[model samples]
Target: MTTRFYRRTASVLLAAALAFNCAASFAYAYSAPNESDLDNHQTYRNHDGETVHSPAHSRSGEAPDGATARCRDGTWSFSRHRSGTCSRHGGVAAWR
Candidate 1:
């Protein structure tokens, strides 16, 4: 009887741990920054398909208006919108 009780307790604990881990993973997967969260800098693939980091746009050396600036691959062609291609290094862009 004692051995059966111990086995049951251990099984319950294991199940609880598994549930917690699954919940944690799901939370992380769906996590994303909100609009209110300031993005002073961003990085993205450029037209040349190279990974590039863009400098933060700041007012008086400080981020203003919460306008998050991000580094993006490809030159900004004023004539066309959404015509830029990814950077040469693939689509990985990161901010400092």
Candidate 2:
């Protein structure tokens, strides 16, 4: 009877620990930054100690809005697509 009671007590303690851990994680979520505060992008610093460009959310066949891209032909263009090809130039494109 003693062993059975000890086993039940241990099971209750384990369940309480697991519940507390999950609740703590959920509470911490309240402090996470909003999605609008973070956007998809990439940044690079030029030799002149300046940020050359800060690219933002962009997609293929859309206006580049001043961003630049490199084509497979070793030329530069602006286009962001899954194909990595400039929709305007018909060549594989990559962010410069």
Candidate 3:
């Protein structure tokens, strides 16, 4: 009976710890920033000392507001940083 009770207690504690860990992970999980949460039209210097604008508008096709550069793949970039800005889209073609 004592052995059975200890096993049950251990199982319960393990289950409780797993549940707490899951809840804590969910609490600290990464969430994408909202447009309203961003500072729109704000200018800042990048690591290269070049003036850059924060991503303001979430648009497609044409160049949106606060676009800093254009990619070689014909995509506009609103990236705040110069490095890795248009790395995925075949690098930056022109700086706007």
lDDT of 3 at 32: 37
Residue-wise C-alpha lDDT for candidate 1, range 1-96, written one tens digit per residue: 699999999999999999998765521111223223333445555454543333333334333332222234421111111232223323324322
Give the alpha-carbon lDDT of every model: 0.37, 0.44, 0.60
| Superior by TM-score: candidate 1 or candidate 3 | 3
**How do all the candidates rank in terms of lDDT, highest first?**
3, 2, 1
Model 2 local distance difference test score:
0.44
TM-score of each: 0.30, 0.30, 0.37
Candidates 1 and 2 compared by lDDT, better number: 2
To one decimal, what is the Cα RMSD in angstroms of model 1 from the true structure?
12.3
Best by lDDT: 3
Per-residue lDDT of candidate 3, residues 2-93 (tens digit): 99999999999999999998765522212233444344545555565665554433444456545677778665566655567777678888
Given candidate 3, what's the lDDT at residue 50?
A: 60
* Weakest lDDT window of 10 consecutive positions for candidate 1: 74-83
